[model samples]
Target: MRFRIKKVINNNILCVTDADGSEMIVTGRGLGFGHKVGEQVDSASVQKTYRMTNPTVQQKLLDLLEQIPYEHFLLTDELVGEIRKRISYPLNESLLITLADHINFAIKRQKQGLLYKNPLLEPIRECYPEEFKMGRYCIKRIKEKLSVSLPEDEAGFIALHIVNAELNTSMSVMNDITRFVDGCIKVIESYYGKKFDHTSLAFSRLAVHLRFFAQRLFQNGQDSGKEEYDKKFRSLIARNCKEHYQCAETVAAYAENVWHKKVSDEEILFMAIHLKRVNLSEQHSD
Candidate 1:
């Protein structure tokens, strides 16, 4: 397909439009070196083309392309490839823009000797281990390619970006979910009078559960419609596991008061079961 250059972003990047008027960002070595507006680009010269359907995101990418170095964008593209290889979940296309912008700013900050710590790093590591591992890989690649050493906190930040893309949510919403998960964990610990072993599988499972639980809470997607089997299971757990069930109730109440979302009975039951497993695991570990 023939592409007409609408704007030359850089020597390697061009903002082009097809015959149907759909805008695309095409990148290749020297693709835009001698190209001007309204010039037809050889399709063979285009190495990569990104079609951003969202106008706002497309504009943001265009603005970012103008500001950040093309190398940073290429580095992000490499990291994105690594992310896809490591996880099977569908990632939002906005990851390209957000992650590239993040890497650009991070490199700039490192040059300025400004180190910002991610507060949710611990929770993120415990909840999203796969994405966090990819984040580490991203920094390792940055160090190899650009010789810039980014802190582990940056890895956490990158993981959150991946999580945001996977959930198709905004960074603010992810922040809220992280905080909510942290709060729920605190509530569980307070009720149990013990801290969780962060390295344990049980804690990891609980954190993962609470992370998605918070997502549903903030998204107002609490379970609806009770089933007879679900009702029986909730009753059985409430009777057999009173302490864990009570802790779950406290967590539900905490969610209701702070997040203003009522946890469904099925959700509470599941929380109680997870809590029981966590308690049992902790006891066995001790």
Candidate 2:
């Protein structure tokens, strides 16, 4: 309950330790303005307290807090609050530092007229709709608070960060997953001889499925379970939806070649079913 300021990060942030010697980073307006080492942090002055157990992560956050503007951390705190309200999943606490660092850098880039387009923007938007929506909210908040109008591409980049936090994975892994999803979608488009309707629910569903498929492939190294009922259902799907099943086969082949992992029949069957829905949705839209 009581915190002794071990170090002052800024006028608004303090690195403190509780009675049990657990380190925590506490933040609030002017919380550290007149604070000194070994000083007790007024409980009322603390608005947010991040209990950092990982020493590496704690150090990274402390470094980030020192380097970036205090207001960026405040903005990220607000964004993380909004994210918790919308998302039911437990997010990695590292999101606080990473998002704040990203926002600060993005604003610096925008001010300098350096705008980088995110190549995975569409795939990200389709695969992670909720996170992408939160990314847009992040953009809106930055514009309102910092007066920086970042490109929509930045929203996709921010969405990836949120996805990384949600999955407790690295950014590179998320990038790989998005790229794999995009490649699989391209294979589907090639098989169907047409582009997908990005806004369609079927396309969104397929994208999400492929995203998780890739995540599973990377994390679990393929599903090898082959139940009799699963085999029967796969056969039934193949027999009923020949064209879509073939498309799914092509996607499976693509995944195998790229990831060097065998795709299970269950995975292919699900892919075929998704393809069938997408095909029907495409026809209806046409």
Candidate 3:
């Protein structure tokens, strides 16, 4: 508990030495209340100690802490480290950081009766109407629980996780599933020169698989169980695309090439034959 103050530089600044032989510049109105340059400073009112972990965040942390009012709670350094560990993609890292920041800010804003309006609302309507609906649903859940509105992207990702979660996958594993989904979406977009819509029956079924993925993430605590969930989701996506969709074999060939897997021509021919039979016979047994 014994600490020494070396110098009182100004009204609020003081040089202090701790019992552990560490010296730091202490700045606060309370620091120099009665303590002079050569006097001992009280150990109380020590808000926090700052030491850089990455050294890259040194400037950023200093800048933020200086301007950003200290909130009741914040994103833990452990959570940030976990994100950087689980995701290697730079885009994902930045997105996850923003997500964490939003969560931190939302908690602080709740006290002021302020709710975050989603800036992504228009974009979600134009670019992802289907996901937007699901996002709205997730927001309803949050609202019912906390009476606070969340931004669309947060709701969207939460819904995506909810829809994608299966009973056997962990969050870390679901992250990979989402990464793969992004890759699949890219390939589909490139082949068709248009974004895929979840409004279609085939895509709707695929979205169901994503929901199962979300279920898995929240339920499954085991790391090894993720592959089972992803395997089911991948198979579900493929099955919906092949059986329920009217996409051309030419399009099928594109997916085959992108996924580096062989999709048999029988898949398309069988779907066509089965569809024709169902149209003509109207018999479930047939």
RMSD values for the candidates in order, in angstroms, are 2.4, 2.5, 12.8
Tell me which of candidates 2 and 3 scores higher on lDDT.
2
**Residue-level lDDT for 62 in candidate 2:** 89
Candidate 2, after superposition: displacement of residue 225 in Å?
Answer: 2.5
lDDT of each: 0.90, 0.87, 0.45
Q: List the residue pairs that clash in candidate 1.
A: none
Task: Supply the TM-score for candidate 2.
Answer: 0.88
TM-score of each prediction? 0.88, 0.88, 0.32
lDDT of 3: 0.45
What C-alpha lDDT, on a 0 to 100 scale, does residue 203 get in candidate 3? 47
Local error of candidate 3 at 253, Å?
12
Instruction: Residues 123-160, candidate 3: write the lDDT tens digits.
Output: 33433345446456645654664556665556655433
Count of backbone collisions within predicted model 2: 0
Model 2: clashing residue pairs? none
- Of the candidates shown, which would achieve the greatest TM-score relative to the real structure? 1
Instruction: List candidate 2 segments past 4 Å from native.
Output: 53-55, 87-90, 280-286
Among all candidates shown, the one with the greatest lDDT: 1
Q: In terms of TM-score, which candidate is stronger, 1 or 3?
A: 1
